[model samples]
Target: DKYTGQPLHNAVVWLDLRTTELAKELAKEGGQDRFRHVTGLPISTYFSAVKLLWLMRNDPAVAGAIREGRAMFGTIDTWLLWKMSGGHSAGGVHATDVTNASRTMLMDLKSCEWHEQTCKELGIPPEILPEIRSCSEVFG
Candidate 1:
């Protein structure tokens, strides 16, 4: 939530299993290994992706923000980097590295980029995803 100091939704930790059902639902779409080949991960709550899907489905505020284009999605590293660069008030940097992006299950491992098709399938809007950059890139 680089756009605001206080985010509407709290971070969903990796250990949370609340999205297990959501993952199962996703698996039903293309099997658990649906995105495994591209993301190197299966559809599971172990990643950030399904957690986000849960939020959007169950939380009206989150869904509204995303629908209105007021939401920005990313993992911890992206948030830290954005804040370090001045946050929303200072036109914070909105980006993430392949490593963090990969954990979201939103990235195409091979291209080190957001997988738009997968995002669509999962109901995640790519417009809200952070830019994918190399780990070596200077964010500041």
Candidate 2:
């Protein structure tokens, strides 16, 4: 969730390709194996982190919101859980299952926590990340 504890709007859709350039840059910096060992993910626009980075760089609204402590991000599941659990208006659960978080290229494949180095490298604040959870447990 955001530092303000609010849910931000217009989550970067996972399929958006706006992050292609940034993805290429990341790949060049570390090759495919850099984060692959920890996240099992190559630097690609397909991941949530890449998309988030793109939004932060290209969309002023998103960037401003984030800097203002008014942003958050997640996969479709995270958004769904937030809404279903009552959202910020209530106290929606800001969480995601490991399987989903793993797909985001943010979670550490080993410990299932937000990878600090990766987040710093990508300039994505760890606060915007959702809580990691097991797939079998109730999220909210």
Instruction: For candidate 1, write residues 1-140 as lDDT tens digits.
Output: 43565586888899998898888888998899999999999888899889989999998989988887788877888788778888889988889888888888888988888898889888899988889988888888
In Å, residue 74's CA in model 2 sits off its true spot by 0.5
* Candidate models: Cα lDDT each: 0.85, 0.82
TM-score (C-alpha, index-matched) for candidate 2? 0.89
lDDT of 2 at 113: 97
Which one wins on lDDT?
1
What lDDT would candidate 2 get against the real structure? 0.82
CA lDDT, candidate 2, residue 104: 80
lDDT of 1: 0.85
Q: Could you tell me every candidate's TM-score relative to the true structure?
A: 0.94, 0.89
